[model samples]
Target: MLFVTHVVPVNEPGQPRLDREAVWEGLVMKANNALPFVPAMSECEVVERHGDSSFDRAIRIQGDPYRERITLEAPHRVVFTRLSGPILGTIANEIEGDGDDMQLRFSFALVIAGTPGNSQGEEDYAKNMTGMYIAALEGTLDAMRRIAVDNAA
Candidate 1:
């Protein structure tokens, strides 16, 4: 299994300031339809809605299909659990801090279907995954900033 966690400041100097509400909205948007935020995801559709707090979505990443159950914890966190995919585990995006010091934390614990745990291949894969996820986090924040600016206009 590969486990990794990364945290990044939400507010960058000179960028459009995003409040908790805006950030929460962006998270929900990404959960529902990731095509705009996740460059690797070519397609996404809501498969089922488990009420206001949870839902299931089908997404295609790099031409492979997968399903994820997404649970939203209001204005704080969004957790994505892989239900059917090459990799199985949970990935969480959490909002931390208050006011101007807000941060976004991304963490995941995943394993390739047939790969042995703690192997060199797994370690290399984990490193690549970490960099991809960090880029995704930055992209998410950039999308949020754009949304904030558009909303404020």
Candidate 2:
């Protein structure tokens, strides 16, 4: 498994003055049909809302559908475990601290399964995917910040 973590400080102008809980409640929870960060993805189809802590959804990306089971820890983190997809493992978005001191971070602990027997091929694949994933995360942070600010108001 490869674990990658990215953190970005929210310091954009005109940002809303909302705390971690408020951001989680207003923006994160309400974002159901589409993910706030992922680019070039279709709207998600929510399968089940398992109480306040978790939910299940299928999101289509590049014509392929990926399913995940998501769990929320109020005021702080949201964890997504791939239930069915090309990648298997977990992605966690965590908000550290409170108020103006909050920092947003994403930890991606994932593995590309089903590709056994070829160690070199797996290494190449992992390298390529990690680069792509990091690029995607960069694009996502700005959007997430925007959403957090907008909803925080």
Question: For this target, which candidate reaches the highest TM-score against the unseen true structure?
Answer: 1
Instruction: Kindly give the stretch of ten consecutive residues in candidate 1 with the minimal lDDT sum.
Output: 34-43
Q: Please, what are the lDDT tens digits per residue for candidate 2 over residues 20-89?
A: 5555663364346445556656668789999877899888765767898888777677788889888788
What C-alpha RMSD separates each model from the true structure?
A: 0.9, 3.4
Please give the distance, in angstroms, between residue 76's alpha carbon in candidate 2 and its true position after superposition: 0.3
Off by over 4 Å in 2: 12-18, 116-141, 144-153
Compute each candidate's TM-score over C-alphas. 0.97, 0.74
Pairs in clash, predicted candidate 1: none
TM-score of 1: 0.97
Q: Write the per-residue lDDT of candidate 1 for residues 21-116, one digit (tens) a residue.
A: 888899999999988788778989999999899999999877888999999999899999999989889999999997689999999999888889
The Cα local distance difference test for each model comes to 0.91, 0.68
